[model samples]
Target: MAASPAKKRILVGQSGGPTAAINSSLAGVVAGAREAGAETVGMRYGIQGYLAGRTVALGEALPDDDALALLRRTPSSWLGSCRFKLPALDAPEAEGFFADAFAKLEADGFDAVLYIGGNDSMDTIAKLGAWGARMGSPIRFIGVPKTIDDDLVGIDHTPGYGSAARFVATAVSEVARDADVYDLKSVTFVEIMGRDAGWLAGSACLAGPDLVLLPEVTLDEDALIERISVLLEHQNTVVVAMSEGVRGADGHLIAEKTVAAGTGVDEFGHLAQLSGPSRYLAGVAKARLGVKTRAVELSTLQRCASHCASEVDLDEAFELGRRGVSAALAGESVRMCTLTRTGDEPYAAEYGTVDVLEVANKVKPVPREWICADGMGVTDDFRRYVAPLAGTLPQQLKGL
Candidate 1:
């Protein structure tokens, strides 16, 4: 009798930042590969770890449904992550690196390799896929999207964004209620995570912040101070949700303008620090308006709050992971899985694929139309766009 087809082997890695739903996507890949009678291996800490020869047999590690269920609920990258940037395919440094990587991948008999990450990670996939094509390698390379920024191009929204957005909205709402307790004129600036785009900060509008500052719109410093002054004239407390990357019309990050020295950049060239914007804005308000001002930087809390995770987000993340694996197994390469929004009322999404080259190193910013004319708030259309992904938030009690 003819022997059955040999089991296809796949290698997957998580890179860049961690999110509440990133592990769920990893679990989905494992489940999908197992169902197809394939072997699934995970890089211990992305491509860098693989080069260091570290990997885990995921199927053997989590052999049952219960383990996968736990993995889905777990926040952060299950396989660890890194920010190691790869050299360009034609760069002098890439020759040895690409040769060694492809040799190792082929030596281990991986039929396909996948990366789960955001923009920078997609860049890795694009480079690897291009290199593989040039060398006529058989192993396919694919990208699975994961980011709290919600700035990945070619997808309606990313998996981690839903959970992060929900957390931001809930946290902002709670903070707003707390700020209202005393009858003192106060302004609280809640800084959220979002570098090039303002999706996360804009999400604070779901909780009805008095103002939402986004990087997409240049900061009018005088106007912001005046707006807060006017807001305090009518109310005892004013809450503003601002993106950490908010910049001035001069096209420089407000955080950089706040501090004298530089913090340096990451391997991917993004600012190593985007935390000072809210504090700077708060200090400015306190000094100028003479009101009680406080800055609250959500920091890392926004990305991995599994308790506030949106069901829709987790479900979509898992489904996308599965679809990505299927696409790679079907001989597709240099592609990233995408989600096309089909319906808004019931909130339906369809899984698809987009060329990884098209998505890599690109940022999808919040649409100008979504921001209010004054650039201080989001429109109802923005709410309609994000509310579904964020799912239902808790209703809080208001005291008179």
Candidate 2:
């Protein structure tokens, strides 16, 4: 569809999880909107907040380049984020929420909506675009990728992943260095964020970890223990990296054992699978293996450590945001701007659009071939792929 003759007023929001480069995307969207001669408004806390009648004009909020520049470097979502999953459209009761969503757009005079988020966020864009089309509304919807999970399909990697992966790698390497300083043998378990994909967890290999557990591979307690035991004989310290979503032989989240009712779920029906893997494994190692253990959960630190944010990730995230605005202005709907890897050495990325439905709510787990045959670590092939993505920064930990 070609853009209409009339100028558009755009509404932008952030949804699902937060990331270090999320703000960079926001800056791009705002700048792109201004450059395209469109008025841009922001949902205070994403669409969920907008439905409650909360919003602000972006031009007034970020009136100058100085403010926009600050936002581009800021970590986390400046517009706030929500995981409020829009119910399936077929549900009769959902009509009211849908009605309100449409009302919000009409009331605010928004002709285009650009949503910055991850997999579930794309689902929201797909739904809203479909709803608008069915209602004969000309409102355009575009999704800008943002996630540390890096599970979204139709792209080489979602924005916010490279920087997070860098942080995780740095944390693993630094934590390992700290653990080894003690004379007594010990095992330090570090848990990273990944619901089902192991990209973040797998990056630990760059830091020289003894083992890397990805959600794509089940957590084999026996094998993990055996490997640690063998390593302890010669090494004073062993560091094991695992994804938070790694499951045990029984097929339950390793975090499940640490909680009575299972890690309570969030708005997306995802396990709030917090630091359980590290704590549980550390507990087990001490009780069964008779070795000192410490569980280190990098948790939010990995996502908010902007000091280590990858320049490559920030640049791509900003460009993706800008591309989303351009796509919507071109009258595109139900489409997402994606990053296609063009080169590895030069680390080039090109923006393209894809049908939102095709990639919505999809999970692209770390490839099995990328995992070592033993399933305890990543293969050399994985290193070759990720090495260039994480920018050149001193990987050295400042303290400890």
Best by TM-score: 1
Count the clashes in each prediction. Answer: 0, 0
Off by over 4 Å in 2: 1-6, 260-263, 395-400
lDDT of 1 by residue, 318-400 (tens): 98888888999999999999999999999998899999999999999999999999899999989998999999988652233
What is candidate 2's lDDT per residue for 52-158, written digit by digit as tens? 88888899999989999899889988989888888888987778978888886888788899999998889899999988988999999999988998889999998
- Candidate 1 local distance difference test against the native: 0.93
Q: Relative to the unseen true structure, what is the C-alpha lDDT of residue 257 in candidate 1, on a scale of 0 to 100?
A: 69
lDDT (CA) for every model shown? 0.93, 0.87
lDDT of residue 318 for candidate 2: 89
Local lDDT at 243 for model 2: 92
